[model samples]
Target: MSEAISYIWLGVLAVFEAPALFSLAGIGIPAPLVMLLCGLLTGIAVGATPGLAGPMAMAVSLPILISVFGVSADALLPVFAFLIGIMKGATVGGAVPAILFNTPGTPDAFMTTLDGHPMTLRGTPERALKIAHFSSVSGDTVSDIVLFVCAPFLAVMVESVLDLPEKTALIILSLSFIAAVMGASVAKGLISVSLGMVSAYVATGQGFHPRLTMGVEALSDGFPLIAAVLGVLILGEVFKSIFDMWRGIRRKRAEDHNADLAPDGLRPGDIRRILPHIGRSSLIGCMVGALPGVGSTLAATLGHSLGKRRHETRKGPTDKSFGEGIPEGIAATEAANSAVSGANLIPVLSLGIPGNAAAVFLILAADSIGGFNPGPSVFNFAAPEINPELVVAFGIFTLMALGNLLNWTIGGIFMRSMGVMARVPNRILLPVVLLVTLTAIYVQETSLAALWVAIGFGVLGFFFRVLEISVLPFVIAFILAGSLENTARQAFSASGGDPFFLFRSPVACGMLAAAVILVVLLARKK
Candidate 1:
């Protein structure tokens, strides 16, 4: 224990001296700190904008960051610090618009609008935003602590017990769970996952022929990950908002702009009353966040519903319900979603699997920069030489801590400022967001083909939303498809193409069985 503490202190000291070691753009300050601040500010602004999200910000910043940092091991620390900051900051900032204008910046924030906007309507927007900030920070802090403690143990356990077939089965099981929980109907979710698999298979095969591309030269290299994700989540949402704004403008239904900022007069008694609810929701979010593909939206929804149940039961079923300007509603929703931001890293760090859309971008960034890969290997305790990736992961945790501090110290002011900003007309704001997203994709890919692909996916995504089909399954499937194919092929080659080899492992068989059962149950319920 003493040796471990010394090593951690050494790592911290080394990080403090990293600028000297790496020559960080001739700046005296450490690059990680600089990037963390930049990402935090950028995330808050982006999240305050109704049509943008954390992954969108990540997709846009990643290429630019790699260009600036020059893609070395030294670059990884700063880059990841920035990504971590954005992840934390966006969760906090997303609540601002949700409270003030009923315009959630991301899908996870959609639940916040239910009670948060009511608070705004009741002239308590400041109090609502304050509740969001405090609860979000509390939840995020706890989730990060859980991730720090649990990731290593879980990774070691998986590394010891799971073989290739077991890993593949686990992925399949994760996909099944995601499909079961994400959409209104399990069939639609499965269909979306199938489409994503098809998309992933297109032009990405290692076979003699480029499969599923139909000889299209532009698709020979397959879809760009950043562009595809940005298109689906960011541009798709932007296009829908644009259409909505146009309709609203046609109907002369412009939002009533409010620029006055109210003070949040939260009492100590109020904070004490909400602490139990925050702790409960944070734990719920942390558990869900650790699972692959079960995202902040579900966490927030569950938290809100559970908190409502508790509130009603306590009130003897006669008092006003949660949606009518209550701090408990904001606490529940914000706590869960913010908690998701930290615990989502558990799957990414321990299993090399993205739990949500934002983790997908982080994995992509790591892959593009090419120093580290996430997996159980990352947590391996190889004694001779240290695992640098683990150190970097710890460093990211530190940066996340800094982000939370920023939230606690200055977040209320920032939230109030965004309340004013949220009143900006969407017609004007969304166009700029759309332009930036397209420009980001163009910058990263440097091909008009990528832009066309993004546009196509944007259209597809908009339709998916309109049809109430969940996009989470599709996105998760697309991101995991490459890893799945590679792992399965490796396992097959080892088994000399014996398809029955997967059944040889009890773990693998059990996971497959679980997947089948989950699918059957979900389908029956649907």
Candidate 2:
């Protein structure tokens, strides 16, 4: 216990003295602190704007950060600190659009739109925003604390029990779960997963020459993952919004929509009233987020649904129901989604598997910057020389704490201000977002080929959206396929290419069976 407490104190000291330890790019300033501040401000601003999100911000900043920091062991902490700030900031920021304009900047905020916009229509936008801020920060803070406490233990356990075949089977199970539950139709989800697997296979020289590049020299490097993600998710949304605006669909009204409400700060009584809802929704988010392949959208949906059920069961059918300008609705959705931001890191930290889009970006950043990798190795301890990845993880937690503080102090103000900004013409907002997105992609890749790839994926994504196909499965599959292939190949190679190796291990067999059962259950549910 003393040793653990000592390590905790050491981590705290390291966070405060980070500037002294990391000297980045010959800059005298404390890079982590400055980057954290920049990330928070940028995340909030971009998240408030429709069609922009935290992953987009991370994608844009990643290459710029790598270019500036020069990809060394020292650069890891500063770079990851910025990402943590953005991850926390964007969750709080997304509520601004959802509450004021019924526009969810990210998929996780979709549930917020149901009740949030109604509150805005009721002229209580401030109150709705406050509920969102309080619940979001509270859930995010608690989830981060859970992550800090649980990740190392889980990683240790996995390392002790899981071998190569079991790990490979686990990955397969995760892929199955994602395909089963992510999309509207199982057939569509399978098709999307196939597309991702095919895309990932392109230019991948896994005991075979690169295929699918069409003999183009630019394709030799394989598709840029960050560019592809930004194009499909961010630029695609920008393109859709532009087309919608041009067609006079989903356009903002020209008249100002700000409401003149009294000071809408939450009182102690109000906090006490909503604390139970926040706790319940946060627990839901944490559990879902901890499961690999399940995501924030589902968490938010489930949280809102459960909260609504609870409200109806408790009320005498006379109280104002959920989604009827009630604070509980905002609390449920915001808390769940915000909690997901932190708990999503659990899988990434323990298993080296990214659970969501934002986590994929984090893994990419860690890969791009050398000297760090996620997984059980990150939690390994060596005497005298601290585990660098573990130290960086602690630093990330510190930055997250700072971001939560920022949200608690000023997030409500940002949310309140969104009433005015939400009225900005999509014509102007979307085009700028598009230009900035493309420009960022260009700067990062430094090639016209990358631009073309982004444009291609953007068009594909637009059509997918139009067809009501979910992109989550596709994105998750794309990110997971490379690791999946590598792990499977490694497992096979270790077993002398024995095809039945997976069935030999009880753990692997059980996991595969569970996956099969889960798929059947989900398909039946659908």
Worst 10 residues of 2 by lDDT: 251-260
Candidate 1 per-residue C-alpha lDDT over 1-526 given as tens digits, one digit per residue, 9 for 90 to 100: 5444544554565456566323557757877877877787777877787767788788778888899887888888788878877887788889988887787767778788877887777667777788888998899998988987888778889989999999988888888888887878889889888888888888887787888888988888888877777777777778877777767633221244343255555756769867878999999999989987778888998999999999988865565578766788889888998898889889888988788887888888898898789888776665467767766666666677777878788766776677666777777877887788888889888988899999998988888887888887888888888888888999889888898878889999999999999999989988
TM-score of each: 0.91, 0.90
In candidate 2, position 374 carries an lDDT of: 87
Candidate 1: where are CA atoms >4 Å away? Answer: 1-14, 20-27, 246-264, 316-320
Give the Cα error of residue 419 in candidate 2, in Å: 3.9
lDDT of 2 at 307: 93
Q: What is the C-alpha RMSD of each candidate to the true structure, in Å?
A: 3.5, 3.5
lDDT of 2 by residue, 60-111 (tens): 7887888877688768877887787777777888888888878776777778
Worst lDDT run of 10 residues, candidate 1, spans: 251-260
Best by lDDT: 1
Q: What is model 2's C-alpha RMSD?
A: 3.5
